[model samples]
Target: MFIELDFESDIPIYMQLVHAIIEGIATRELKPGDELPPVRTLAADLGVNMLTVNKAYQHLKQLGFIQIHRKKGAVINSDEMRQADDEFYERLLTSLRPLAMESICRRLTKNQFLTLCSKIFDEIELKGGKC
Candidate 1:
């Protein structure tokens, strides 16, 4: 698992860690059942606090992205990924709202915005991973 953290970014370290791990899973760099480094080890490697890694792991578990075991440590969720339900669609819309607003404000046409989205989807799919 290769994770690059931008120390200077405005986003919180824990959230960045969560996103990185999620991206890794999406790209198939982290397959189901893969074990993540222990919290203390990952923290030391990333130069972040153990609490941050723990928090990120907890969040991922909550989102059904990974499972944490006392002895097994953190493993990618081996079960089939959860299907997107209404709650997920709601969350997705909430997350995309701000970006949509920004795109509108920036005068990005609907087609252009959709093209960008398609480009991203293509890139991810080309990496031979399902989203």
Candidate 2:
């Protein structure tokens, strides 16, 4: 419900909402089994269209981040977030390939790129940040 959207961003509004929720989960701001606001209520609160919120919620559901129950609405899944599968790994590579190529094209070495990634991961502190 605290998700913020930048309408001017190149990223789609729904995806931004998805990212915010994921961040919340990762940062432990949203604990397992926590309930999210109802779609209409959240849309009203965020000043976004209902469909936008619905789309974001649907995406989260597909990723196993949240489960929709008739009585509970959208509640975070109980500490069983979907693990990255082979397809997910392939997609991850597909997404990173262009970025790697771009770095090479810009005359950055492999070590430089790896170092940058290492620094980012270190800053994120993935282990400590997990929900």
Q: What are the runs in model 2 whose C-alpha is more than 4 Å off?
A: none
Best by lDDT: 1
User: How far is 70's C-alpha from truth in model 2 (Å)?
Assistant: 1.0
1-131: candidate 2 lDDT, tens digit per residue: 47889999999999999999988887778889899999999999999999999999999998889999999999988966667899879988998899899999999999999999998767656635564
Taking the tens digit of each residue's C-alpha lDDT, what string does model 1 give over 1-131?
77899999999999999999988898898999999999999999999999999999999999999999999999999999999989989999999899999999999999999999999888877877684
Which 10-residue window of candidate 2 scores lowest in summed lDDT? 122-131
**Residue 28 lDDT in model 1?**
91
Instruction: Please give the TM-score that candidate 2 achieves against the real structure.
Output: 0.84
List, in order, the clash count of every candidate structure. Answer: 0, 0
RMSD of 2: 2.1
CA lDDT, candidate 1, residue 51: 98
Misplaced by over 4 Å in model 1 are none
